[model samples]
Target: MSRRQLPSEIRKIEVLNRKTGKKVTRYELRMDAGVNQNTGQRQQVKRRYATDREARKALGEIAGGSTDGTFVGRSALTVERACAEFLAGSHSIEPTTRAAYEHALQPLRDRHGDMPVQALSKSDLDRLVNDLVVGTSPGHRRKWVANSINPMLNLISRVLADLVAQGKLTRDGAALVKRLKRSDKELQTFSEADVRKLLKHVENNRLGHAWHLAFSGMRRGEISGLLWSDVDLEDGTVTIRHNRVSVGGQVHNKDPKTETSARTLPLTPALKSALRRAENTQKVERMKLGPDYGPGEHVVVDEAGRPYHPDTLSDFWRELCVAAKVKRIRLH
Candidate 1:
């Protein structure tokens, strides 16, 4: 049978079959962004109808600027645009997470700047992430590289999801994002006994305060911003509501890493007593600072009574661990 020549404005609608990995047509008419909203987030939309008369009727609605009835094809979105939107929507993300997402996109953005939304196949993205996973070794990179790669893969998938939400992509970037695996050299969490022993060993170490906080599951930033005002001394409750994070090279106060992360934990007797001693020590140091005591709000501060960089606290943690006879495993 011969095919009839279609009008110039209408076009075919395409969808990718995730299982079979092929683009198949729905045999419908589609229009570009017009005066109305259509399919996902375009200024245009695809109006599918049983006949030319119905298609023309739908087109009239689109032309007249009413998105009353139109189907959006999911392939007409771009990855770069999606990434931008994703980051914008994620302003609430912790600084660490935001930084990680930007770092994850560095490779792809450098490579696929011109990739069209409709042209990005699942395999294409999967290959990019998979290449990162299998290309490096612990000998050259850090041992937990796969762990880093997996989180970045998840971030990329999230970016693609925003595209899907905006009706830009049907594949949803799942194929590529799911293949990123955890590295074999991921951190081995210390046993409870190890945590206790580490705490006991660091009883006299500078990290004694930090050890108490980490063992209690307070994130480094939360503990760093721990204030004397939030401690319930008589009740022995440590209320965690503040966090100090560094973003774009400057430190700022932000929400806790997650909702569950900002919680009140009951201080064990050990913790309570340790906190008292630490407070006494801090007061002595502050007194010696003479005229230099700066309000005395932050519970964890340097000798100068100023908040230390959260990252520097971690370095001291490693040093304390080594001094406390804790084992350091090197995957490299």
Candidate 2:
């Protein structure tokens, strides 16, 4: 076709091949990349592709990104570097959340860490979803359910979004990828009879007050991090101020999960009485052990007066279920 009849954004060009010293035909995609902020004039960019199809796809990305003010000139930014920078700059997230994101992004990093962010396409993301669904990705031994796979996709989406915002990516193809459909499962909870049995079994136990706190809807982490100063036995009130969560086999003491989670809660009559007994028992143990007993402000403690680890408390509850002959349910 004549130059006048050719598409405005794409055109064929001839270049000298370095090795053969012969002219080769290549398709060029040229577009208005938007005005440079440093200068008051418009900026444009050009890219050459071996095939018309490749040039057209890149043209689409540039057109969309330019229209939305998301386009920046191409560079050698790779998926691995983008992920690493995003994770490193994220300081506001909880440690547990950061750990979860790291795990979710592993597959993507392994599969496409070296791929240029500018060249990543929708088909690549789709193939990743397929591989994850069928458990065909490297290091994955079993198929992943939708619930398990969604978070990984979510992390990918977030990374892509950050890249676009930073002008490293022309557009976010990850947003076009569909999340897997999750199948719902019934939530299991303790029945009234199960609760009654558990309460009776632990009523006289050493950690009875701690069990009462769990039964009152306190999260396991909250109970593990509870301090005596945060509890008022006389006023029958408990303030939730801390949460000790396990991340990578280690526990971290942090603030409550949210602002609302740090509020005060009224203590039930049963809970109040349990707390009184626990306090008195601690006093007796302190006298018996003398200087050998460890001292702390924690409400829940072992015979040695050390605060319970969150994971250890979960294990303790599971064993308690079997001893109490009650149906097993996770103590959250």
Candidate 3:
């Protein structure tokens, strides 16, 4: 409503979780010096500290910066605006990664899309998480509801970290949210049998090509944008070099999910034979088209030697997974 001023508003600390007896000290940080980029209404920040010392430390951080250091006091911004900035910046990242963040943020936007940046609190975040697990939304997808909670917390962590780096908020805000842990029941990874059945189904009926690579731990885009140059036929080793991700409708190449993901995996004999057959089939089709043959060196091509979209390939993998067991090993 009205413009709020500097010297930073006071913080209130109370029980955040009555059941767990968890508590937090929160501060409504004000902007004494910095200017708001959008509304020109001066800058303000909302922060939560685990303790009084943490709160004071955050204050010193904001006060220490001359609108330029590790912290800044900015106001006149809304949660939606900050979210937009965060999402826009994530375009440089891989699509699957960006999608993960978006999945986490979706429920938050649906619930708290209207709250201003100056008024958000740790409790507000706690509520978003609580509602995600226990709240009911009629006709909503159950899987979406269940999986949406934790990553939203992670996204909040990332968003606050960015604000801290830019001097808008302090690290405490990020730190405060990261402590909200999901229950043991919330996490379910694929079982070894699940993996084996899924993989067998994929291999026998429709391996989806990329499906084989991802189950083998290849990053989605790595398998999507893979080229023959990155693979060694003689050695049967696939060296990952790049990934293609679509961010906001633009397909761009980026690095693998992690540096470690850019690795070499020996092709199984079955996989090698499959590839050989697939190539033989493609060579004949290319002849039928004669001059229409696309560029060579692209693996996992369709009947016409055309490369497949990684996203579509992902969906196909999901369906086939439902029908088949994925291969997995147990470690002692």
Candidate 4:
């Protein structure tokens, strides 16, 4: 006698009746979910779909996911969970970029962290962007949307793409989130008189040398990260090598953002004088602090000779602007 042949292991769609024997509007898909690791027994999973085509597509995806070990049931994933997974697995991201992503994504996480990834429709994403734009001030709405909301949406979209690649999501929801057209705004700057007033006001301040470099077009981080080794008082030049950055309130020294950013900058007469004054002043501070002083090679430092936190310089600049009665501009 011939051996009995088994049927193909393909999922099937079934039409079911309600408890009252009335026909339901949707179709049900049932399939074996493979053997359970703990129980060593076959498990089953079921899904409901609005149409035969939907059922077939989902069934095909489920079968493929099982074979590839990428299967993630719809009920088992959320936006927050997906984000966490993505962040945890993204080992190649730089520290500064990762920190920016974390900060930018916080609002989205607070709003839709628990929403299911598969359930986030285009309308939902549109509503999120609209709500964020409405909540911002009229004068700053464009900036806030462009810098914060748009970046957050892009990051979420990246996470969704990772989920799709892993078979957790059928498509990226962020693809539907439209980017806003950003118009160019006039750059804010201080007048020559205001600049002179600001410089004069900071002449006696602890960050006097930093203010001089700031006016010379050196970025805040580059100024903060300066070392005596990187400065040539005789040549009146400052080399842009390292940059000190603040992320989540912590300070770190990293290389300049670009190769062009590492070029040498000529110092003005006032900057040369300021650097000399700072050098003399730090000598006195080192004498007073003795072993407690930790200036190392950094040119810009606090009273204790420790390097200044990058963000603290901005705060000081704001206060100095107020004192000088000048229009406050960003420290960068």
Best by TM-score: 4
Query: Predictions ranked by TM-score, top down?
Result: 4, 2, 1, 3
Give a tens-digit lDDT track for model 1, residues 106-221.
66665565677567666776666555556643222323356666766677777766655554454465535464445466567776676677877877865476678777778777
TM-score head-to-head 2 vs 4, winner: 4
* Model 4 lDDT, full chain set: 0.79
CA lDDT scores, all candidates in order: 0.68, 0.86, 0.63, 0.79
Candidate 2: clashing pairs of residues? none
- The regions of model 1 sitting more than 4 angstroms off are 1-82, 89-94, 136-187, 191-197, 328-332
What TM-scores do the predictions have?
0.65, 0.79, 0.60, 0.80
Instruction: Give per-residue CA lDDT, model 2, range 1-332, as digits (tens).
Output: 55344468899999999999999999998888786543456878888999888888888887886687766776788988989998998989988999988888888889999998788888998998898888898887588888878888778888889877666665788888888878887888888988899999998899889899998889999999999999998888999999999999899989988888988999999999999999999888878888888875799998777888888899889889999998888888
How many clashing residue pairs are found in candidate 3? 20
Off by over 4 Å in 3: 1-74, 86-97, 135-150, 157-178, 182-220, 245-252, 318-332
Predicted candidate 3 versus true structure: per-residue lDDT over 152-262, tens digit per residue? 676777777776566555453434754444446743467777766665665644334555566666766677678878866678888888876656656677777677867
RMSD of 1: 8.8
Error of 4 at 74 (Å): 3.0
Better of 1 and 4 by lDDT: 4
Candidate 1 lDDT trough over 10 residues, lowest sum: 136-145
